[model samples]
Target chain A: MRKLIVVLTLCVISSLALVAQGTPLPDSTSDSTAQLLQQAHALYERLDLERAVPLLERVLSPGWSFGMTKAQRVDAYAYLGASLALVGSADSAARYFRAALERDPFTDLDPRRFTPGQVAVFRTARRQTFAVGARQVSALRFDPRTEQLSFTVVTTHGATLRVEVRSVDATPGQVLFQGESDGLREIAWNGLMADGRLAPPGRYEVRVDGRSRLLSRSDSTRVYFDVRHELPALEDTLHELLLSELRPERYPPSAATGDLVKGLGIAAGAFVISGALADGDLGSRSSALPATVAATAALSGVVAFVWRRHHAEAPENVLANARRRQERRLTNDAIQRRNNARIAQTILVIAPASGVGP
Target chain B: MRPAFAHASGPLVLLALAAGAPTAAGQWTVQGTGVLSVMRHRVDAGYGVEPSSGVLAGPEVAASLRDRLTVRLWTRSGSFHADGPGAIDRDVAEAGLQVDVAALRWLTVQAGTTRRTYLTVLARQPWTTVALGAEAHLPFTETGVTGIVRGAILPGVSVNGLGHPDLAIAVASGMEYRRGRASAAVLYSLERYRFAPSATATVERREQLAGLVVSVGWSLKR
Candidate 1:
């Protein structure tokens, strides 16, 4: 009996799900709000206000059976407001128009597409709603020397507004526009940092903050972008020379003794060879011959020992090392100059990026 | 000088010119040196010994490339006066060409040829020889003082009126000092020749020459 009861409950739930799929539900997204707005626009063009009004109102309603982008939602509110205005519901039209204006202060009704009454209603909505917003950054690359990066910002009504371009690090950035601004205003930036240098490559934000002069309300909005530098590849400087690369500047202590020993050894060799190799029948060896070389060698030994002892430093090696260091410095300086010139030719590459904050 | 010496000297002059030719790489050095030597000459012919002495003086030119290879040509002429009453007086003239190749920092391998002529009232005699040798350098210091020892063996010897010597040897010990481009050296040199008894020459003959050689050099290129 329990199994039969559970089977009947499952059959009822399956039938309800099929019915829900066949008939659109308020909480189920069966169509995009953009598509619904398009349908309403077609209906309103045919003068079917009763059918278009319901469709556009459903798109703007909370928990409505559709999803939408910010632009699509704004389009739905605009169409609903225009339809109601033509039907003589002036208060309802004004309310829907203000909702679109609060979302995007640059929102407007085109006179070619809408009646004069609807355009007037949009203007009125703009005056009542207080909002500030920045347009998406366009992808562009321009040399900072001549061209500029442009940004579009708006205030719903005349207000004291400030627009700033800064890095994502929240560093003090350059203010492109300030003072009273109403509606849409184009701001230009020369791609320079606050310190009058070319803007370094990084993520940057374009922020617009305004306080309405008529109302005591304020609004702020920001858009993010990535800045890249389009420049020639820079060369790297050579590294410092190691100790092994340079010649020794001082002679070792053993050098003096070694010199002395070498001289003495030569003197002894001359005497030994003269005594051992000379023929006895040659009427005795000439003492003067061997004595001259021995004396010179022995004297050289003494002189070398004294000279090496007094002059411990090797001047030749020191001079060579200094010249090497100077050469390295000159090469590095040339590299730095080339790198600076390449940096001067930098072109800022700007592209829109997803923002992190309002 | 005998024509034989001029022929032996030809290849040495050519080699020196080749080594000294101007090149974009390596260092070249040409040094001209004045040589002064006092020589003692002795001859033994089984029965008696004849000793004589004389002074030999001449000029030598040396050309080196990169301090690694050197070529030298030298000539010295002098008269030897006999000490004994019956011995004959003779004039001696010698010329040599030599090449030295540095095989290591302190050692050099050498090959050379020498020609000697004895001019007497009775006859003119010529001798030609080829030798292989090595020299060892012992540097005293960075100031350019060096000690040198050299030894050579004559493998080919020819004499106008005598048989080949059973043994022929030459050796030298010296000291050299160089400052800037000027250099000076003093060396003790000895040469000996021994001939065994033969059918044509019944008596064993021996000859020896010993000398003190001093040189002053100036470098054309360093």
Candidate 2:
């Protein structure tokens, strides 16, 4: 029984040693690739290249079932390169470094965690490989007047770089920077379109393209984000005036004929009153008196008809309509002024997005 | 004469009211008009007809509220002489107070009181009448011109030393042209009365008056 207990203790101690040294354990359903990367990274920190390299390679293998984040995968490749460089395999180390750089041009070797030889191998890989990258946008809010939206981009080597923020549909966009760039660069945008108006809110892409001066290779990268406006509500201008609001500028065709009829009616009324109501005993109603009114009425009728026919335009109505239109224009202009003021206070709200672009 | 002067006080009271017209609630308009009138007068009371013509001048005041209610006061005075050799010569004075209430956009119902006094070389005759009427306004499209027609019946008429007439009516037709606050108007008017034969006078009495009136007016609004 004593010998069996001693053998059990030895087995437990050997397992603990193997786990700490990052020795490949039996692949289990619960063992995630990220957990394996952490173990390998820990071994690499302790300068255990022999165990760390094999564990990192196994995590990156095609047969690995566990899912790993992009950051975790990049970490695995970087650790493999560092471990291989420490073991004096310079060519293999450079190959892994190039792979990591291709996945992420912003990848770098921490001088505190890596030796000069490992860092030199990473730098040599960067010179040989061409890659461009932009950091994923973090959630932020800024006013265009006093602050700006910031983006971080990188080139693997000295290269001509162009960084632009554009809508996903390829509408004309603003170029943040276009010049020779080396290493890491922070580009800023003032939330304006190429036409100097506030950038409309929608899904946008921050595209970075680079052409390496040291090599014939070129690379491009895209990072998508959603832009939304945080602003005061804007007012709408007045619509066109309705017909009832405006006076008719021209008289209808019936108006002239109607006036003629009205005048004739007046003449007939006078004649009826003089001839029918007047008593003959009152010495025969003065024909001159009644005739005076009838003639005046009939003449007025003729004159009105001729005047209305020749003058089709109603000047009073034209003036009234013009005044109404001017009043409407003034009202709409006031509304537009208020809307522009509200838009000037707009705040750009930016957040990371996916599934937007090719 | 004292009673006739007292009867003329009705239009004076209306004129005072128009001068101090209330304008606190709705739109108010006040108009002042200068009137010139030409009249032909005749009378037949069991005798030969007497005919005469006269010219009169007067002032008229009107106050309107909300284009809905209106009050008017007017007075005219002149002398009539024989136009034919029928022996008619008298001095005439008349005053009236009228109120118009709009029943529709283009129609108004009116009530008024009129007092007319005739003075001959021997005596004075006074006639008091109450009238109910309707007026129609026809506006010419966009021309600032309006045609007016008015008819009224004298339901209550009283004259000293005379019986009430069996039939009495008045009618007028006119045209008005308005530009801004200034306006000019020309109107033809007629009044007729027929009285039944009475015990004191054996024959029916008939009287008629016809005239043309022209007025110019200025308006103020608040």
Candidate 3:
């Protein structure tokens, strides 16, 4: 009796599922809700808001039949608003975002996405209080490439600052100081030696000093001097920056790729050994299989040769051209650097000594 | 239909394992909540609430290592409770890292590895909530080196790859006229992902998924 009941229950459940599947989807006329969402997504992906706004407005219309929860409605509003702002519709986007926030207060909506202009004002104000103490110094490293010398300074306050090309080793020496109000700075070198002539590509020492009156900081300074070489392109410089910023916990695979490769090799070896063991009759079959094996090998060789011939062709000719362009860009950048260094040297020589700041 | 439930059960067990684990501070955070689509379609009946779609919810945890370095781990599990054909659901997790090297006052360098569960683009998107399993970003990486420069021309670029059936490459570049609480950045991203042959029968029919996303954001804190 119990078995029969269980069987009946199963049958009923299966029948219900089948019925549900057979039932037609909600009517197309009632699909304005989904249509609105599709339109919004399409517009957002295309980076076009001009066409998406009116469609979204119609979908949000009160009479429109969309079976959406209050929360989902709020999300739609937020996304629509954000999309509008991205395409230069700030006022309208702000209104939508604010409306969404009112509907759903829990949303961690990023205000920054809505207001690009306001961010500049905020940063300027914070720059006024920018001051660093000696205790804030954590670590510092220097890198010199074919184009510029960069200094990476890590601070205890979770800030990483950089200084670029403070002085060139060549003639008519010029120094460039580049610093940010947010504890970041750089200095450039203009191909001039200390004696005011073109300097050789070699090592040089750089120094930085800072004092703030509001913080009552005097003589609280940190200094680092390191050897750096110039890089060929901005790409190379950027690559160096990425390598320096890799954190172990955040990017463990980057640090462990070597180990992973070794492990894969070991696993492959084990698979081969197991396959050999499984073919225990290999000794008996060797003589009989020699011809077959050779034929198979020959066939595989032919196939591989054909594949190689076809695969050897470049898949991306455009990419090859792009690479050539990149090389040219690098060359141009080097030339620019050299010319800038010469110009700086001329300025240094011609400028009045009294114009120098302390 | 029964098999789908069994397939869905596996992720549920994993979720139970994660939830049962002891909570740790700085190890977890309420990242955010949103809805994700199971598949892309032209027309449907409802709007906001997707009874047949998956409900996306999860936590994100970011921790610092040795002051200058930080690591972040996040997971999102979405499930749909519906009866009938085409009921869809999935769960995903990701981990990534960020490092800051201050060599100058104006530029800082950053680099790191990321697993499938931690792609930022998928996390930031409103629809398609499945955390891009194989997507990782080296946001400030140029060549193999990562660094930043301050003053005059503040330039940066990054290379990213998506894991899984679609091994895609994305290159991004950004410029910031940064000040204090108010800094504006214009970021441009281009991505290309190719689908596998085996994916023909599934919803992943497109041989390439290419798009561009440009975003500008600002923040204010008390």
Number of the top-ranking candidate, with DockQ as the measure: 1
Choose 1 or 2, whichever is better by TM-score.
Answer: 2
Tens digits of lDDT, candidate 1, B1-222: 333343444454344334334444447688767788888788887767888878877667787888899988887777788877546788887898899999999999999998888777778878899999999988764757788999999988888657889989999988888887788998888888888877767888888888788988777563
Model 2 residue A305 CA deviation (Å) reads 2.8
- Write candidate 3's Cα lDDT for B116-220 as tens digits: 221122232111112121212222211111111111111221212212434333332222322332333222222233333342233332211111111222222
Deviation of model 3 at A273, angstroms: 47
Which of the numbered candidates is closest to the native, going by highest TM-score?
Answer: 2
Per-model TM against the reference:
0.76, 0.80, 0.17
| Model 3, position A70: C-alpha lDDT score | 71
Candidate numbers, best TM-score first, in rank order: 2, 1, 3
**Clashing residue pairs in candidate 1, if any?**
none
Stretches > 4 Å off in candidate 3: A1-358, B1-95, B98-167, B174-191, B195-222
Global lDDT of each model?
0.82, 0.83, 0.35
Rank candidates by DockQ, best first: 1, 2, 3
Candidate 3 lands at a TM-score of: 0.17
**lDDT, residue A16, candidate 2:** 89
What is the docking quality class of candidate 1? medium
* Cα lDDT, model 2, residue A154: 96
- State which candidate, 1 or 3, has the greater TM-score: 1
Deviation in Å, model 1, residue B95 alpha carbon? 5.0
> What DockQ class does candidate 3 belong to?
incorrect
